[model samples]
Target chain A: MSGRSHAASRLVVAAPYLWLLLFFLAPFAIVLRMALSDADTALPPYAPHFEGFATLREFLGKLDLENFRLLADDALYWDSYLQSLRLAGLTTLIALAIGYPLAYAMAAAPRHWRPVLLVLVVLPFWTSFLIRVYAWIGILRPDGLLDIVLGGLGLTDEPLRLLNTEAAVLIGMVYSYLPFMVLPLYAMLEKLDRSLLEAAADLGATPVTAFLTVTLPLSLPGILAGAALVFIPSVGEFVIPDLLGGPDTVMIGKVLWNEFFSNRDWPLASAVAIVLLVVLVLPLALLQRARQGREAQP
Target chain B: MRKASPGSLRRAFQPWNDPAAKPLIEFRHVTKRFGGVTAVAEVSLSLYPREFFALLGPSGCGKTTLMRMLAGFETPDAGQILLGGTDITEMPPHLRPVNMMFQSYALFPHLSVADNIAYGLKRERLPRAEIAQRVAEMLALVKLDGLGKRRPDQLSGGQRQRVALARALAKRPKLLLLDEPMAALDRKLREATQFELMDLQSELGTTFMVVTHDQDEAMTMADRMAVMDHGRLVQIGPPDVIYEAPVNAYVASFVGDINVLEGHVVAVEGDLVRVETGITGMVELDEEAPALAIGASVLVGLRPEKLDLSHDEPPQPFNKVAGEIWDIGYLGDVTMVQVMVGGEGGWLVKVALTNRRRRAARPFAWEDKVWLSWDVEAGLVLKP
Candidate 1:
């Protein structure tokens, strides 16, 4: 019976591995192969077509870094990459600044009200993502609902120029990802031992000092997880920028979309996609290594 | 049960004995209510300097609430809290000069043991060298010197507990509150840690207040303990005094294994009160009896160990009860025998006998007739 159960458990573990191997790894391999090929006006749009084993070997040997070299030579790609990093960083910071206190409040709420508050935080997810982004356009456009509300409140004399701006993109991104930032933070803060705060206060630490030394350091895992969740996706986000940003906002996601569909340069788009993945994965790997290093210590 | 330790025998340390001596901490009719339930009713208490005091009670008895009030975690709805004769009821927890060792230890998991001990000192903005020296001293005091670099999870339970103590003491506060400190330890480690905590308190000369439900822990470690029930203090005295003379039935039963027989006062002669009990026939008590009227209902309490049990009947002129053994439990060093007295509405009296010899045969068996006797002074008179 034990041996049979062991084999059953092994099969259960292998199911997800096989699924990922077929779907995720296979697609990534295809993209990598496309990234190495040359752009063309043919039906597939790229590559010396794979023929027999001899042609495949010859094609692999002849693959060059010309696409990456072209990307480096062009100022548009560089500007778009820098712009994407800046916006992603700003969006992460704003999300953290707004989400930390909100998550803390949710965790510190009366025990009976916690579930209700958590559901409200995640309530935005039930609606379609595109509809939510579109809903913001109605609020942000000049002489729209926001302008009327501001005029009635007498906070502004004139209708504000709010639509199709970088600020609007940032606001959309931060709002879209706020729940992702809060859930992890709420989980961490909720599980925090309240006595530690009392113990800190029992020491000479003030409330602010206690938060800095005890609460803040202990909740860092949640903060890092939340930031990464918001940062990596926002780096390559296409919808919010395309719908809310002005012409001046040249994010790499839009650049990659224009390269693939408008310019029909699949190889250049694949190279850009590869660079973006590398950019996101490097810091995440560093974070995992740092966590492991701390765990490895006595 | 035993003689007072030499360290507690000093007169200067015994502030409760002197009428003019001021208390270190005072709670004046403090009351706290949590929504509809009163977690702590109007209660007044005081603690003297360098005294290892204990608040003993079962769960939901307000013992923990009283300690939390002192720690400033909960504020009293009405009344003032005085520390060293200054009202501090309005002071926030961070401003108070008292530290607590939480029941869960609450050691910061993200920090090493050395860093945990240094947490409080760093708040004081002390010099770096002084902080390091103090941390090192605390590590040595807790006998966890070489294990300073380890996290709290990496250490054993006892070591983690000691680290919590060391961290709480690192600030050298005037009063250190311990909330069920031994609830996390096993029996053997608890007993050893209790003595170590006592020795440390005596050496540091810091006033310590411990809250616990274990009667043995209160009796063994506390210089004096306050027995609480329903948010009110029933009795407060040294362990010996409390054990020998409990003020009421609740204190008697809560403190240890006891047999309370309901009776009425039949006769009162000066300091002696003779009570008629259906279970034990007639018993006499040597407590002050002027306040007790004739034929008034009262409770007669007897400690299990105070009663003598034997197969042979006792001589005449002794307060004795004849019964048959219903059950026997052998607990390594001592054997507990439960005897049934009086026919239908009988009394079950528990008697403990020390097992002096390992190979000695059992003296009494189940359903065997036995006689139990005790002195007049052993019976504690209480109000019904």
Candidate 2:
């Protein structure tokens, strides 16, 4: 009976991991395979052919150079990449500026009020994310709520243009990604050695000065984690830009999406996919490494 | 704050108070409460220039809260905290001239030992040369001159404590507060550091307020100590005074091992108050305290080493009690023998005997009938 139970326990422990391997790990391999393989038409041609590799090589050789040139020559591709970088940078900065204060306020709030503050910060997450973005459409449209309120106040003669701008896209990104920045930063700041701040204060730093020297530096790991979290996805995001940004706001995700669906150029899409991967992989890897470095500290 | 202790004297001299060598810090009836529970209640104390004081207590006894209030991390719900006679109850911790060495020795991990010590000086916006020179002096004072390059994680527990000390002292605050400075170190290390701390205090001559639950740590370092229990100050005096003459049962029990015999005052002799105990026989204590009427119940606290244990009853003009040896603890320097003298609450009659190689000298062991006695001058008379 005990032996049977032991085997059952082993199976129970192994089940979740097995499920993850089957669902998550297998899908990534499929994506890699899909990235490599050529498309003949309606569906992937499933005959055994090293044609995928041949196509991949040829694709890598001249056409790949053209993709590179596409990024370099026409300012659009390069411009989109630059805009993505710019948007991501702006979003990260804005998120950090807003989230740090909110996280700090949450962490330092009275014990009873803390959870409610946290919930309010995270309430956006519970709401339909898509609905929130759609709500922004209602607010950011020229005759939208924002412009209507401003016009009512007689701040401007015409309804102010808000939607389909870089600022609008950044606002949307920051709103969508706030909790990601806050939760980690809050967790870190909450567990901060208040004594370090006291020690700083005792040592002769004013409150704000102490925060800069002690509290801020100590929570850097959490800030980095939040920044990476917001940065990684924002650079690759298509939905926010497509919804909020106008013609000039073409991002890498949109280009890849256009190649795949609109132009039906799977090879070109794959090539663009490869370029996006190249651009993102190094930083993401470095971020993961940095996180691991913090943990590795004894 | 007319009714002030040594700590209150230091409080009056705090930088924000008098701005000169006026007492440093003064606690004027400062009380703190956590909802329904009061942590520090209507307590007033002071600290003076270069005085080393201690707030000694058991766990959850409001000492830490008092220290926090002084540091400006905690606010008093009633009354005000005066820094050098100036009201600073509302001042934030960073704005206070006081610095604290935290119990955990909270050192910054990312910065090197040098930078950690230099942090406060840097915050003051001192010139680079002055900061460097001060940091070097601090590193040497803590005896970690070459270790400036190492981060806190690289140093041992003692080294980390020294770094924390150096850092707290670097800002040249009028007061330095240490919360269990040696608590993290092992027993041997803690003892060594205690003396080093005394030396450091003497060398620097800065007023220090240390909070510790360890009685020995408090006694060894503090010039004057205020013992607390259940959010109240039980006694405030020099180490010898508090130990030898604790005001009540709690202070005596908290400070050292005491055999408290419950009794009632039966008679009064010249400089001696006689008490008849339920456990021990008639005992005599000093008549220094407020006079107690006959038949009034009291407790006589006797230190373990003060009592003499013998196989044959000793002939002396002192109190004597008879009991059976319950247990024998063989500590190398002093062997602790527990004698049961009782009815309801078993009396822990402790007697420390010198461990001699001579067989004849080893008098009593487990289960042997023994007589425990002490001089009239030994035990203290306190009310429970």
Q: Scored by CA lDDT, what does every candidate get?
A: 0.90, 0.82
Chain B TM-scores per candidate, in order, are 0.95, 0.91
Candidate 1, A1-298: lDDT as tens digits? 6999999999999999999999989999888788888999999998777788867778888677888888899999999999999999999999999999999999899999999999999999999999999999999899888999999999999988788999999999999999999999999999999989988888877888989988899899999999999999999999999998999998999999999999999989999999999999998999899999978876
DockQ of each: 0.85, 0.50
- Model 2 gets an lDDT of 0.82
| Docking outcome class, model 1 | high
TM-score of each: 0.97, 0.84
lDDT measured at residue A289 in model 1 versus the true structure, 0 to 100: 98
DockQ of 1: 0.85
What are the per-residue Cα lDDT tens digits for candidate 2 across A1-298? Answer: 6999999999999999999999977875554444554555655532123456658655444321343445457766777777788888899999999999999999998889988988888788778888899899999999999988888999978866879988889989999998889999999999998767767776777878878878888899899889988988888888898998888788888987997889776655665666677787888788779878866754
- Docking verdict class for candidate 2: medium
After superposing candidate 2 on the true structure, give the runs of residues whose Cα lies further than 4 Å from its correct spot.
A1-71, A126-128, A148-157, A285-298, B1-25, B78-92, B316-318, B342-346, B356-361
